[model samples]
Target: MTKLKTVVAMAAASALFLAACGSGDSSGSGGSYKLSFVQGVTGDAFYITMGCAVQEEAKKEGATVDIQGPQKFDPTQQTPVLQSVVSSRPDAILIAPTDVSAMQRPIEQATKQNIKVVLVDTTLNDPSIAASAIASDNVGGGKAAFEAIKQLAPQGGKVLVVSVQPGISTTDARAKGFQDAVKADSKFTDLGVQYSQNEPQKAAQIVTAALQKDPDIVGIFAANLFSAEGSATGVRQANKQDQVKIVGFDAGPDQVKALQDGTVQALVAQQPGKIGQVGVQQAIKALKGEKTETKVQTGFTIVTKDNLDSPEGKAALYKSSC
Candidate 1:
């Protein structure tokens, strides 16, 4: 009888040990998850809004999230931040890769450690390693920008694109889409694209120079928020506000103000918060061993002065903080 009691106690202890081990798997089935969100850069209203949504969604899933981002939107800066996050061994990571190629290996490292990775906002050249990639339809957004320009400058004349650096998936796609659409229409002359290196000052300089070279340039497409800000500044500095109609991407508060103040003609607003919220959902699904959509494309809103005060426009604007 004594021996039988001892055996039974050992069997119970073994079962409890196995249960504890299974609960540590980070599988959401039995344990809370730890999630990390790495943004393209810190201090951008777009990313801030996304981060806020990520936190909110993670809370709903009973998971905790830590948000990190580089000061600049550069692969070199983002890699170190990612590596540090990977070392912390979070159950999942949602990141916006700064460069399509440069960020590939660093993100792969996270996946190799068995941490589920979801690409948010921007993606890599090879995105297969990530559990999911979620972002706005940047290419379509770019084409829409051209359409807005066509409407603003109905007669059609010389046009230029102010874009961020190449190899950035989002901006690159936007530039390509706009250029392709411009080519399709013979009425407009493509003055080609200029890289802003993600600097509003550089974008301003590029715009001022381009305007000087082609004063008759009737339309301009600024591919991102900073580019839009600088393009408006450049148009103002060159005193071409009345001459050049501008269509910009991303509707931050400043961009909205620019539209209302007539600094820009129209704005392409992406659903950044939705992307973040969906990113968290996908990561949680991946952790729970559930099916996830490999590639999810969110929609955009066109914000003009006509709809600046509308419900849709207000909902589309990015938040500065949570």
Candidate 2:
């Protein structure tokens, strides 16, 4: 009977302890189910879109989610957030690990108490703590970027990589895949990878610096929406828009404008709205003691002017999501 009650207590977590889930304090009203959400940064439209999806799912599931994260993709900032989340001892935690290795200890601590941890939008180095991880096919997405730009520089010119956080696994994987694809193809010449750290001004600064180093850089890879916009700006400021091709990951209103203007040749867009719905579905499965897939690939697709508003493109952004 005691064991059964404990099982029920653990299972009923979301409903019984809402505050602790995200508050970093175990004390709560009790029975009000809580969830903790630690993200990279909410400012980026991509992460913001992802958070919206998670929040929507939490609402539908009637689970209280405290979503907190760094303003930028800084592990130093998110580390304390993770620690505070562990301190709260919530029923579960949804984290987008900024640095997979740095996050191991906190996740391991939560595991010791049988608390649930779900990694969304990113992954961890030690995958043991997260019951499941929902993310885009980052490597595949990067490959798509390389394929799109290969034609522009068939003979292989310099390609500058503009990115947000340099250490994040998702960005790293995508960048690596893109570089590998270019390297494997003898026709391609690799430039180098640079960091924007997801800051618009920073991205532009880095792009400007990269351009100065390689005046003939044929392509620029923006690893996310913000960096993509900045990349376009950098190209234009240098009077090289028509000469340089820019490919971006993720999309928003600004990215759309860039695409239409022919500044951003293409974008790798992921469904942010669906990411929210999927997160809810997985959480419910966990609540019901049902088996869930360890890694659910949310997926990403290439977006270009040719398909910007086509039925297929609209369909991708439709269905109540990104």
Candidate 3:
């Protein structure tokens, strides 16, 4: 009887222990909700920083997050990844669509599965399908890029834009904003926009050819990280670094190094971390059946060589990892 009593007490303790462990898995008032974050591409600093923020915010809410993306920023590759995530049936998904049109249908399927979808950093043509869309003011960031270039090249001359492919909503809006801003200013001549196809080599070739055609090009606005990197290299290869001023859109580590080395003049840094944080918040709100914001536009910072070490500049810079 003594042995049996001891065995029974041990069994009761084990059951309580198991129950406590299960409850500790989620601390929020609401049960744990699985979340998925799909980036425009894997290995990009901008998206990496956003993913880090998403993980941090999810942890605070006692939620679990899964981050995935394609090797390249292509809809063909991202579509498969999105479909796989949808099949897993996470409670919510946060994604940065590669192309505005191509990603529409794949994302629609997620919505049809009753998954709460949040668009972060990029959006589709039919964004109504998502619970909320959060991103920087891309058009305004482009305009700000032009403004930085104007400050670098006060006399203005011919200015050109090296951007990603046309179908990308963010880069396209950035190119338009820069071109429109240049058009408004008579001192600046818009040399038109060139597509880099998100290839650094292609962007470098484009910039080198543009410089060869018009050696007098004064300013260049690179709409994204690869474009800026290649533009800086092209200017250096042409030995025109002192002549052409470059304003890049994202403040990746490479872009900041370029600014420090005097290869680039200024950078427009978007609030990607903030975008990701808000994305998770919105997703949780939707999962909880609370009011969720349809659209949220984050802000940007203009980083230059002079203020590169400032607190704001440090905060604005993108992270390679969490």
For candidate 2, write residues 7-67 as lDDT tens digits. 0000111221211132222332344457777877766666667677777787776778887
Q: Write the per-residue lDDT of candidate 1 for residues 254-279, one digit (tens) a residue.
A: 88888888889888888889899999
The TM-score-based order of candidates, best leading, equals 1, 3, 2
| TM-score, per-candidate, Cα-based | 0.92, 0.83, 0.91
| Deviation of model 3 at 289, angstroms | 0.7
Determine which window of 10 residues in candidate 3 has minimal summed lDDT.
1-10
Candidate 2 achieves a global lDDT of 0.72
Off by over 4 Å in 1: 1-26
Residue 210's lDDT within candidate 2 is: 81
Q: What C-alpha lDDT, on a 0 to 100 scale, does residue 264 get in candidate 3?
A: 89
Q: Could you say which candidate leads in TM-score?
A: 1
Question: What TM-score would you give candidate 3 relative to the actual structure?
Answer: 0.91
Q: How close is candidate 1 to the true structure, as a TM-score?
A: 0.92
